[model samples]
Target: MKTSFDTFISEFQQTDNPDEKYTLIEQIISSLAIIPYGHKNLTKSEMIAHKVFVILRDYVIINQLRQKHAEDTSSQKVLLNVSLLFMNLCNNINETNITVFKSLFIHKPLIDELANCLHEISTHGKYLNDPSRLRSVSSLLIALQKIRKHNFTALEYSLIAPILFSVTQCLCSSYALDMIKSLERNFIQELDEVQMLFLYAMPLYVKWYWDYCDPEYFVKILRILLNDFTAWFTSCQPESYLQRSSQIDAMIRHLNYFLVRPTEFDSMNIFSEEFYDDYCKLVLHWSSILSSILACSSCTMNVKLAARTSVQILYNLTLHLNVLNFMKTIPSFILMLLKVTDLDHDEVQLNAYRCLGKIMIEADIKTMTKPSKIAAVYIAFLKDTIDDSKKTERFYSLLESLKSKFLSIVFFYD
Candidate 1:
């Protein structure tokens, strides 16, 4: 079986015709898939699998290099098949055979090939319609990521820098849309696999290469995800209907990571007008997410509380970002907060009221021409919450500040 597999690999690799090569490779893969692993303490099957993996890896590497520079569409398709085969073997091959797989070569070239392929698919035009090609590329990267978990090195860490840079570009590119569409064909639309891949992989990149956590990388990754999150936000079925999904959870995890690891990411020059403006946009986008989550009555109180906390955190981070415009732009913002203000959670209520205060002040200034009517509108909106016995004293104080700051001349007799 081992010798026949080796013979099969040789024939598959040596064939000049792409059609025959693909056919031969498919047969080889089929045969390898069904080979029982238990024969003679699994030695025979493991040996055959190991040999097949080595051959697959070598062929994959060779073809990846060819694919890297190949201008001919035929060469590109053949190379793509090699990647697909690599993914198949990686998925089907057992972990025990990995010991044999490790002896073949250094991971750097494979890593480089994987990153370059991703970058290629992202930057090139022809590969856009090829779902098989894109999935094969993503699968190779994910397989590498999995292997790196148990066998890491400085070289591996070094390679991830470029991998992440490419990934960042990949996410930013128009190809990312294709990648998302391809993944959705296979997975759920709401929690897109490609987006989830980046969301998970970027943090892992940070974990491995902490020194690479500069502001440029930070801003690029954040903007890419912010754009994706916005897309998800607009297209997502309301949270009420879908059971808990990764869409919201993924964004929350992303925010949670940044919030917890501030020393790594917080040193951006907030004073720069451009940076500050971009930051405000990012924060406001995040605020929209929180507002959406809060508005969903089906979401658990815990999730709502979490969303409120995230809002509070954003408010704290961007005290200077004109929080009022953020609130106003997000149509659900004020209403979401009002709903939360009467809730039993003190922290959530306080945060909601505080956001309300910002909105009132902004409303007063923005509607200065019609300040009285605007203030009346806001007062009328808050009248129910104020009437609630659960309202905290500080909540009233926040409302009073809203009045003083927005409508000081008009005294409230109550």
Candidate 2:
């Protein structure tokens, strides 16, 4: 009366030997692979799937505990097989089996263990070129993606922090990229949502690991964020509105942190010259991206809001002396700010002009060759300010401050 599933579970539980457990897990994976998608019968199928998931989850937890003492090759093989089994189960998940799947795997202990396994595999240079590790990592990421899909709340900041750090570390290797690309090609065809999942979690990731991650790591993270933002902006999917906003906000706020130079009162700060240089380069790159977004005549109102927010951050950067000096080095960056001043959006134009005023105050008049052109832009901006009846008195005050600075420059030029 024993089904093959029952028999496999019995053998899997009885085996103390890793190799035997690995074989049984492989058999279980192979057997699960044949289960037809969307079968009508629920009771028997759910019970069987639940038992398999529990067995694999238990084995992974035990193996993880054992791994603390020593590295076992046999144990790693079994772990890879277990991950493969989880991937197979994830593929077969449906409304019928989803509850069972979430119940067994969405717990913090299991997620932490899986993250630990991924961290171990990803951080080791020896595993970089190993096909088994690649498969294991891909399977683990798919499993995590399923968990993320089913219960995003379960992946709170604490649980997800290590996973994000590990994945970022893994991405340093070309092998990991190949593995992720393979996953994208084989499983999820639309886009690399797995990578986007990481990017989406970036606000949390940076919050938790900012002090720990190196400047180069942050540079890499920012680059990925910008690239994803560009893609999302171009495609402009209706559903991805929140995603785009979150990414834009995260990038802008993260950049905002660099604008505030660390003072002697700040004991916990990790500010360094190298980090400053990286921030300067990122600001220049982000300026170019923002210019394109603002210049796009067809961009949405939401995109305009994002650009305005970014311009405000850029203006904030010009307030800091060191960052302002770095900003002054890039004349094209200055021109981008000036060009933004000509845009129709009031807040964006105001912020861009504020940024320009800051630059003009510190920068020598000769560096800005077109003094008349600059004066014309300021005059037009001041005229627009006077025409708006709803314009706050604060605007008038700021205009006068900038006006005096520009007048001094014009006098020197004359």
Candidate 3:
């Protein structure tokens, strides 16, 4: 007897009625759900399973071709159901079933079709009027992301950014949030080693959609993403170190907008009091991570140096904004800055001094005047840099300004 998957697809292909075809497609997907639960070990019985998926896969390609002219509701339903079935297989594939899942390779036409359908309906507001269509389209894209063998080229990945933009643009904030959660859920659960390339594509995706997404919703999405990234960074395997670092660097490049102009974001209620509260907490959290990395002796010199530089950048922003009260508690970061002040790289040294200067200008007189605190560093930094005039003017100017403030305070006290 043929496998249940084979039997269903055969009957599914015979049906010309869209409703009947949709029902059969649903049954086919329901039957495949057993693969993820480990009940169907397709690896051992790969031949039969491969046959089933190949037929199903080809059926999808043919219907996708037909779907172009399929304007009636019934035809739309059948085409959508078939598309969902393919996505379901992608999402539900596991180690045991991956061999069978590989049948989806080279389905670029079908992939493009699904993306186009999603964007066309979404851009035109079809999904908005019918919530189910929105969910189905979103679900289809989420599912397609799971197919490891269908690696998207950079050009194809670029197509994804606009689809994401269109979807988020047309949906309400609540539904947009739902769609984001589904995409994230699939990224977390459905992706495996072979599928990790998509992770690199994500930063580009976020960058493209950043300006288009509603600030309110984007910030929430960003927070969740930040938390996930931190967790990934902290527990990451060695193999992923470079990829994770690149992703973090790309993401921070965009986050600078919020860090640089909190007021602009606040005007839109993007940085409202509630978000600012969360913002302060997240800054502190990342501060601790950077400090730990800087302090860890076993870490590579390059990594430690990078972390030190990031600390300077973070403190410079926080101190200048004066938004987070907890910045004062992280005094250890001051010494890290002083240590990097002696580095060979001019920009790094400049950033270190700038950060220290900000901290000193913001510190209370007592903190500034302590023997080993700003006073001692200020004197040494100024003395050590007396001969280096290459862009050293800015450093001296900042130092002189801070010293003047500190001296005025002391003269008043005396």
Of the candidates numbered 1 and 3, which has the greater TM-score value? 1
lDDT per residue, candidate 3, 131-155, as tens digits? 3343345445455445423334465
Model 2 Cα shift for residue 17 (angstroms)? 4.8
Under the 3 Å rule for N, CA and C atoms, how many clashes does model 1 have? Answer: 0
State the TM-score for model 2.
0.39
lDDT at position 209, candidate 2: 40
How many clashes does each candidate structure show, in the order listed?
A: 0, 0, 0
lDDT of each: 0.51, 0.53, 0.46
Per-residue CA lDDT of model 1 for 48-158, tens digit only, reads 345566556666455645463445555455555555545444443344555443343335666576667667755774344554455455555545544443444566456
Worst window of 10 by summed lDDT in candidate 3 = 186-195
Please identify which of the two predictions, 1 or 2, would achieve the higher TM-score against the true structure.
1
Top TM-score prediction, candidate number: 1
Better of 2 and 3 by lDDT: 2
Better of 2 and 3 by TM-score: 2
Error of 2 at 65 (Å): 10
